[model samples]
Structure formats: C-alpha cells, structure tokens
Target: MAAAQNTPGQHRGMDWCGFAGFRASKAPMQAYAAELGATMQLQVQMPRRQPAPADIVEEYTYTRHFVAIDDPVRLLEILPGLPADKNHTYEIILKDKPCKLCVDFDGTDGLPACFASKQDFTSRVQDVLTDIFLTEFGVQLPAESFVWVFTDYPVKFRAHLVEHHIMPDGRILCLPQHNPTHATRRRQALLQQAGAGHA
Candidate 1:
C-alpha cells in the first residue's frame, strides 16, 4: 500500500498528513512509524465498567500508541500502506503544530453488532477525512482529494458531503445524503399520507 507519487496540483499546499483504517493492527502502525523515520510509544489506560450484575464491576483497558513525525511529507508518503481496520484506533500528531487527524471506526461496518449490514462505510470515512482537513487546515478540498486505494474494501466515491454543512451558530450537522433506511421510512410516510388524502 505504498502511496503513489504526488502529481502536479495533487495535494498541493498540504502540510498535514495522516491515514485512516478500520481496526488497524499494531504491526502496521510500527511499520508506518518506521517508514516515516519516527519512533512509536504505546500507552495503556484501564477503565472500569459495571454491567447488569450490580454487585460486580469489571475493569477493562486499551492501549494506544503515539508516533511523532518531524516532517509531514514523510507521513504523506506512506499513506497507502497504513492499516484500514474498524476495530482499532490510530492517529499521528505533528510535533511542530497543533494539527492532528484521527480516524473513528466504532460505528462502521466492521462492528457487526453495531452495523448488521454494510452501510456506505467508505463514503462516511471520506466525509470524516474531509471534515478533519477543514478543521485542521481550514481548507475545503473537493471530495476527490481523498481516495481509498485499498482493494480489500468495496470501491466507493463520494456522493455528497455529509459533514460539510456548518450552521450559523458554529455547529456541524452530518446529514447523510444516501441513507437507505431513512429514505425508506420517509417514502413509507409519504405513501401513507397520500393514501389518507385519497380516502
């Protein structure tokens, strides 16, 4: 998954670089860090959780690693090889600036209990990447600026910008344009109303 060489006008003026993955593994993280000529450090946090058994409480812990790169260009060069998993979380922050990019994979199709069926996972990821770019760099790039080069996942292109709608009060609204279930429910309601009007 080595990143392709940057062509003219491609990702120009971009000082930030990061990758998104669904449940990506640690091996890939280390690999990416090595490629970027950086060191990786792992941090583990333990939290307690209480379930139906009120008397019993359980503690769980998760580990996260931090990789700092001096040059973002090095990070950008290895974008294609980054892990793309839904179960794990990964991020890299620039040491010089307050710029960072993170990928959230909790609700994606990777979690079967949460997502029984595969939704438009790639499009959602693209929207999130776009939003992050906007937030970090304050630049709005065309949807095509981001591309999913992994062949393991279904090929997807951006249908519309779901997270780009910014309200006047400074709140962001994510209105998915191609939600099948929402569209179905709305269609059903419309048909019912039309039937009632005729009766």
Candidate 2:
C-alpha cells in the first residue's frame, strides 16, 4: 500500500510520512531500526517499541514506501528483500498515477534480486513496466503522463520530480524520457488523419 510522503518544505514528522505501526525487537531488526533512525534524523521518525501486552507482539513501524524488509543494507538502498523465487511488488508512478505491479522473473540466472542497486533496479524495472503499461493500457496515456516516470521508493534517499533535471534522492537518475522517432510520430498522425476522414 502507498502512503502520502512528506514533500520538501513540508512538516517533517511521522504525521507527514503517513507512517503506521509495526514492531521488530530482534537484534538485527533493532540494529536496522537504529541505523535508519540515526540516518533519517530529523527528516523522519523512528520511535521505540511502545508498551504492549507480553502475549501481544508488534512489528516495527516503518515510515517509508517499501515495508517488511529485514536487511539494513537493502532497506537503506530502497529495495525489497524477498527470495528470488517469490514475485516482487512495486508501485509504479506513471504520470503521477500510482499502480501496483507484481512480476516474477523466470530463471534466476542474471535475474535481478529484490534488494539490488536501488537506481539500477528501478530503472530496469520501469523500462519493462512502461512497455507493459503502454501496450495494455493503450497508446493514449493519461493527461498527467509525462516524458519521464519515477517511483516513491526511498533508496539511499528518496528521489522526486523537480525542475533542473530532477532533485537528488540518493539514487542516481538513469531513466530517459520517452521520445518517439519522427517516422513513428508521422505514421501515428497519418493514422489519426485517416480515422478522422472516415468519421
């Protein structure tokens, strides 16, 4: 599920991240939370485990896009940590519209693991997703569709849309704008003109 994140110049707090609750008290989980807490500092929140009944356990409440990650390295990289066998879930933000994409790659050889390099992983995944969306959803995209696309997954940091190329979000930007060849555009225009003639 996606939650509203704190935009720049906005209030910096759990309230801003729309962060909910979960508990992780194990040594690794605790260490991960500590590191994240220290790293995020004032930009985000990492509260300690709240009081609860002994029988009733809780999970660590994460204030980020992705969730249920055990590795600090992967989490910090804004990647998921699931077995290669399992399908990974990603939130694709196309033209400012978010959609869930669950995909399972065939054959593990050279296949991307869940928690790989944040930017590289996202770039590669989005490339394939663009094809899928464009073909399945149709050539006419939403009004908000832009030449470039991105996601809200927080890597070393969270990347965002802004003027001057793009604001740094810790992940290196590698996504190229969708530029159709001139011939392709001409053919599309001809097709439109022909259809209009029929109408």
Candidate 3:
C-alpha cells in the first residue's frame, strides 16, 4: 500500500488556513508558512485549489481545442520539496471555455524519502521559480503571475483563470484548458499547417 498521506497537521501546524498554528513555544513551521503565503501571493494570481478530482469528473467533460503550458521548472517550483526522483508535470488546458491547470507528480526514477525535508524543498522550488520567470516571460528573475499551488498527494498543482479580460465579441486572451494529450495534438496540427504553407 502507498505510504500514508501527511495529515493536515503533519507538516507540524501548516494547515489549510495558510498559517501555522502554535502548540507551545516552538514556531518552526511559521517561517515556512510565511514564505509559502508570500509565494502564493506573488505567483498564483488566482486563489484556491482547483476542483477536486471527484468534482471535476462530475461537473466537466474533457475536450480538445485547449492549450498546454509545459514548464518543467515551473512545475518543480510550484511543488517544492518533492523528491528529485519524483518528476512533476502541470498541464493547463481548455475545458468548457476556460483554462484549467492540472498537476501530477510521479516517481520518475523512484520515490525517495517523502520530500527529504521541507526547507530543502522550499529552496529548490524557489530556484525553479527563478529560472522559469527569467526564461519564459522574459521578465526579471521573480516576475509574478496568476499561478496557484494545490495540496495534492505526491504533489499539488493550482491555477487561477483569466476571466475579466473578455471581449464583447467573445474573444479570450487565454486558451481553453484540456489534457496534455490534446495540447500535443494541437501543437502537431499547428506545425503541420505551418509546414504545408512553406515556399
């Protein structure tokens, strides 16, 4: 059987409220909680975790015509402390006229000791974030965006949608949210179209 998922308090007081509760004199988890809060505030533009798996299944149907954001570094940063062997991936796709970001982390090599430790995880995550910001957005090292982190087992991936920037003609600045498979299909289609028109 899989190792037990950490309890809400397993991280030692880092609960869902985004604050670490104090049991006594120790406040070890407080620093991490503050860092996490700041990270969420700067990176995740939207608040709250994505719909649960059960809720997603009950409410939505997976479709094509979506976009995919394949940023391995971003994935690493968002899920700080995951084992190196545990590879994580996030897919933002088009579903129901909105973009949804889905995250999953698997044992690429093999699962190491549950994250190694939170501090190490957080530092590594920050490094990943730095790289992602510089390379993708071509902005500074720590540019902020609308990304959120969820608390899923193995890892969590979160997203906030771009809702307000809609046009009267029904045009969307962001693409739809679908699975990575669909995104791959879309990419191939785009490449094929581009190739066909070559002189």
Candidate 1: list runs displaced more than 4 Å.
Answer: 1-92, 107-109, 112-119, 125-140, 147-199
Report the error of model 3 at residue 20, Å. Answer: 28
Q: What lDDT would candidate 2 get against the real structure?
A: 0.32
- Tell me the tens digit of each residue's lDDT in model 1 across 103-197: 22221222223222334444444555556557976767466544333212222211221223344566544332434455445433422332311
lDDT ranking from best candidate downward: 1, 2, 3
Tell me the deviation in Å of residue 65 in model 3: 32
lDDT agreement of model 1 with the native: 0.36
TM-scores across all candidates? Answer: 0.23, 0.22, 0.25
- Residue lDDT tens for model 2, 124-175: 4344444544686543223233223232221212222211112235432222
Stretches off by above 4 angstroms in model 2 are 1-44, 47-116, 139-199
Clashes of each: 9, 7, 11
Candidate that scores best on lDDT: 1
RMSD, model 2, all Cα superposed? 17.7
